[model samples]
Target: MAHVATWKKDMVSEIVKDITENPVVAVVDLHGIPAPQIQSMRADLREHAILKMTKNNLMLLALDEAAKQRPGIDKLKGSVHGQCAIMATDMNPFKLCKKLEATMTPAAIKAGQLAPKDIMVPKGPTPFGPGPMIGELQKIGLQAAIEAGKIAIKKDTTLVKAGEPVPPGVAAMLPKLNILPIIVGMDLRTVFEDGTVYKKEVLAIPDDYYKTMFATAAHDARALAIDISWTTKETIVPLVTKAFREAMGLSISAAIPTKENIKILLAKADNQMLAVASKSGYKSDAIAARLSSAAAAAASVKPAAEPHKKEEKKVEVKEEEQVSEEDAAAGLSALFG
Candidate 1:
């Protein structure tokens, strides 16, 4: 017995030292794990984390010794009862926790094991057993009648709440309701890293949480890629395609005018603008040229600088001609006389 105690103490010391030195440690409670299942779990955890099973008392003692740096180390002592395993790793805690949950299978439930939450099984008809268990089934809202000397649940009735004690009646009806009171999946008890501690409840994340996280991360990544002009299957394909089409239109006299392509561009714009105009039956080029000529003529018809100069000059010349005619007539008359 003394030797056995010594070995246990040494094992506890090892665990404590390992935890303190390692930057990342995940504490897993192995309570209620069956022997075969534990073996399989060990194999599964081999690649991701180191799994250790130790006594509660030893773990508590080691944690007590290191209370200064790890203040809440004692809290982990409570979860070491029944059968518990400590999983330690340096990987991302949330991701590792998620992967661990994916490796669960159904198992039988034992009495006194705490229910993680309300245990619910649907209401169903119980098979006829004509046995003592039938009485228990009827108490929990299950219908059981004797038929062909066999006991089964005709239909499942939902279990009311988690942690609610399973009455003997309901326990007997388990065969029929197909309700197993065991938590078969992996439960993350706590995670510790970088002198900090995180409990299982906090890390007991849901599928949607990771889904939303990954989705948001993906969106941000795509936005960054676009900002840096890093084209990929995600960003460049669609945006580049749009840019290509726009550039082509600009090159083909179909977009805004520039000095190099102004004439052709304007011509196209003019044709398009006239398409909705009154149908004079004129070709697009003809209509544009006529419009251009009209604009030029309107510009050339600006008001003259001296508005009455030409009119004054014409009046002066007309007066001079009249005067000359008068003078000539006088001379002719005088000569005849």
Candidate 2:
């Protein structure tokens, strides 16, 4: 076998160490980004991750070596392409993806390069003074005119649609118009964690994606638990409260008197008696007021109105003044006469 340099072997060892030690390892594409920007990104990511650049062969070798300790880590070898760098981070794949996305910034489109999106020249004043620049803009299909001693585009124009190559003339005109039509950054390739490889599309998740998922899952879990009555720390209080409410409702509907619902039952019975007396031509002030209110409500028909929850008034009657339940039921007949 040909002799391999000691430095190359040491570099491979270092990469393998990073892959094995860090819980999260990622591959990112650095193609087309400037060196200074990459350095700045490294500083920005210093606290979160360790970005390292090495030969593709060295990285592939490192992946194979790391696969010994981290099974399936070699699956990341495919992401080791041109201008690739690996990062060792403690952040989960989702968070890392978000951080990586923040690195993108507007960059000037070069000649013969593919347009990232439709290049729009709006109808407004431009930064160029009138002269040959007007002709340059017109040559690239812009409706440019000289107004107020400066060149102004006459109408909104799309010089290049998305996925179309930036023609040489259009490319020359864009920089002069101060338009940066392309986005450049470190494009994340894959994330490796616990022998699993997460691709770019999979890792590209909205910031609220997990939060919304967790919230929905928690709500569903609580509802399912209540349905099946599964008891746990988070579900215990709600379950108990629900059970108490159901029991109270059942007692009231079935006229089964209990200490909790006794006062409500008495109030309900009194309302029923008053309703019966009023229907039998009772002319008392209270009956008149109740009837008028009922008529007003029936006329309006407010279906959306919530059930009115009246304040409960406790009346402590003396033992000598107390009336039995049967006497109260027949009490409305006396008011009717």
Candidate 3:
């Protein structure tokens, strides 16, 4: 057996222990990032994660060894290229991604560096007074002019386009214009959990995305369950309400009376009787008086609609049934909201 250095063994063990303990493990790219910034990021993430940096070979060895117990952690070794570090956290992968993204700060672009996006100089007053500075700005392709006794850009100028190398002259003037184009910090490459690897694009989601998705899913699920007449603790109330509505409609059609639907049924019958009497030209004084009264009442106000009524009554003479919206909402919120 080959003799391994004690420090190397300890480093690998430390990494292995972190992987096994924390549910989230990630490879973060550290290319072109300063040591001071790395220290600051480590401090910021101290509460939510553990970040470790060492030789890439040692990291690979640790991942390989840990995979013996973890099964698929070695897959992360593919992301080990470039200056990188291993991070372990108990936080979920999505949240960890956001946390890491939050650590990024705007950095000034350097000469010969590739521009990440279009750098625009807005048309506005500048700090420079009328002097040779105007000539310097014009040299950098900015439409500079003297306005209100101060240097002002004539129009918004594109200092650098995406993927284009920033010229030395343009780079020097960006700081004077207060435009920091490059985002500098620890960048996440891939995350590992439960034997799965999540890439940067997959983890980059809005903060409320999952919450919204879960809520929408819950709503669709409840709607589907109701459509299928499937009964569950969540769907029982709607199902019961539907059943009661159907039962009430059936009873009215068959002229069966119940306390809950009796008023609406009576009103409907009265309207029907009046309609028949008016069409038949009946010669009864009581009928005439009643029809006049109904007309006056109709002109003044309309009765409540049957479809919108939610007032609950006993399906059985002695048993009371009710659905608490607050309770249902609470339960659904606990489950999917």
Task: Give Cα-based local distance difference scores for all models.
Answer: 0.60, 0.82, 0.84
Which ten-residue region of model 3 has the weakest summed lDDT?
Answer: 313-322
Point out where model 1 deviates above 4 Å. Answer: 1-8, 14-24, 32-36, 39-55, 64-99, 108-140, 145-156, 175-177, 192-337
- Ranking of all predicted structures according to lDDT, beginning with the best and ending with the worst: 3, 2, 1
Model 2: clashing residue pairs? none
- Residue-wise C-alpha lDDT for candidate 1, range 1-337, written one tens digit per residue: 3455678778776777766665667667665667788788778777767777766666667667655566666556556655556666767777777766766666545444445566655533344456787766666776656666765555655654576655555455455556666656456777766556777667667869878999999999988887677879899786797677667566764466555554445444443333323244434544445445534554466554476555221101111111233433433333232
Q: Give, for candidate 1, the lowest lDDT window spanning 10 residues.
A: 313-322
The stretch of ten residues in a row with the least summed lDDT in candidate 2 is 311-320
User: Which wins on lDDT, candidate 1 or candidate 3?
Assistant: 3
Write candidate 3's Cα lDDT for 1-337 as tens digits: 9998999999999999998889999999987677888999899899989998999999999999989989899999999987999999999998889998988888888899999899899999999999999999999999999999999999988988899999999999998888889888889999999989999999999878899999999999999999999999999999999999899889888889888766555555555555666677765666667557556655456555488777332111111123244432443343333
lDDT of 2 by residue, 56-134 (tens): 9999999999999999989998999899999999999989999999999887888988887898888999998978878
Model 3 clash count equals 0
Among these predicted structures, which one has the highest lDDT?
A: 3
lDDT computed for candidate 3: 0.84
Better of 2 and 3 by lDDT: 3
Candidate 2 TM-score, C-alpha based = 0.70
